[model samples]
Target: MNTKQMIKENNRLQDAMKPDNLSYYQDMVVYIRSSSVEESKGEELLLEIAQHLLDAQAKGKTAEEVFGSDPESYCKELVEQLPKMKGLNRLQYHLMIPWIALTWFFFVQALVGFITTWTGGPVERMTQVRISTLVLIAGGSYVLIHALMRWMKNDTFQPDEARRKINVRSMGIYMAITVLILIAGVWLGRLLPVLTIAPWVSLVLFLVGIAGTKFLFSSK
Candidate 1:
């Protein structure tokens, strides 16, 4: 089965597990799927593990007893054994989020320009952004994502309630940091060398970004 098929099957099988068992198993699932391992391989391993867990459940075995206490370590071991995404594939994987954000940023600017022209207001055909602002936004995004992934890895072994709390707290922190990044970018943009981009250019870039992103992320 493909990754999507395995995911659906895994979900159906997981629904039959006891709440505690499902929670425990899900941590491993999240950690493995989020790592740099190949997608199909990761989902295949998860489906296999899910099936094993269900079989164990029939014998009244808990997830912890079946998979041991250190699920994170087990997942780490499996990730090591799995084939890692490399070269252009790895580049595409990592750049997917940032590319989408940049694409939408251009799209919004282009839309605003068009709207201004249509409304008979001052023709705003140009958008200016500073080099320093671009650097900070990209660097900050990478750091934030890296930190969040680390948090996910570390939180995998915690209890269900604790995991939920961690996730909520992490999300809050992530949003707060994002706001700070945007504010800093705005401040730096005012002080740095500005590059003016035309609406037509932005529209072209938005189109290219969309096509590139679709190519990079499309399921094979």
Candidate 2:
């Protein structure tokens, strides 16, 4: 079937299934997409999987029975079997890391500044040396994270359609979370003078928390 027909059929299947079965189907698609190396291939796989699930449901079978007990392993095997695409150069990937890190660093800094101002704390201007150090550390962190993902073979396929979905509500939620984190960081910094003494300490902790969470979730 064509893409539009596939999507419509998928939606129909989702509506027909019980909530629990629908959840299982969604989770399977998420797993398959995560394992896939190419966006187009991932979408195709999702549609195919959805169709299979629909057929199984029509026969009064559960998703588990249709796939297997270990759906994640099956998805991983499927990913391994997919033909490799001519991906970006390894050097290019490495080079983009620092830029991504730098963007995140500035975003956090801006959030912190706004939080401190709102909390009636004196916003301290960072010294050039301190800023430079933070930039270096952020760059280093990006390299370390990339290396760790590669070592674990958990590097995500780029251009994910699900990730590319632009939801204004999601963006608002993220902004709210950022504000909350900044406020919490400022409060914590006040309680522990070390974080205040070294402003980047909180940033580092935040980054570490994110990396740790990603690792834990992706492992499953």
TM-score of each: 0.78, 0.44
The deviation in Å at residue 39 for candidate 1 is 2.3
lDDT of 2 at 188: 51
Candidate 1's C-alpha runs over 4 A off are: 159-192
For candidate 2, the TM-score is 0.44
Over the stretch 86-120, how does candidate 1's per-residue lDDT look in tens digits?
Answer: 89778877787677777887898787767776787
How close to the true structure is residue 74 of candidate 2, measured as C-alpha lDDT? 73
Candidate 2: lDDT of 137?
Answer: 49
Give one digit per residue, the lDDT tens place, for model 2 in 86-156. Answer: 45423333445564565466557656766776787877653112443454445555645544444223212
| Residue 209 alpha-carbon offset, candidate 1, angstroms | 1.8
Score each candidate by Cα lDDT.
0.82, 0.56
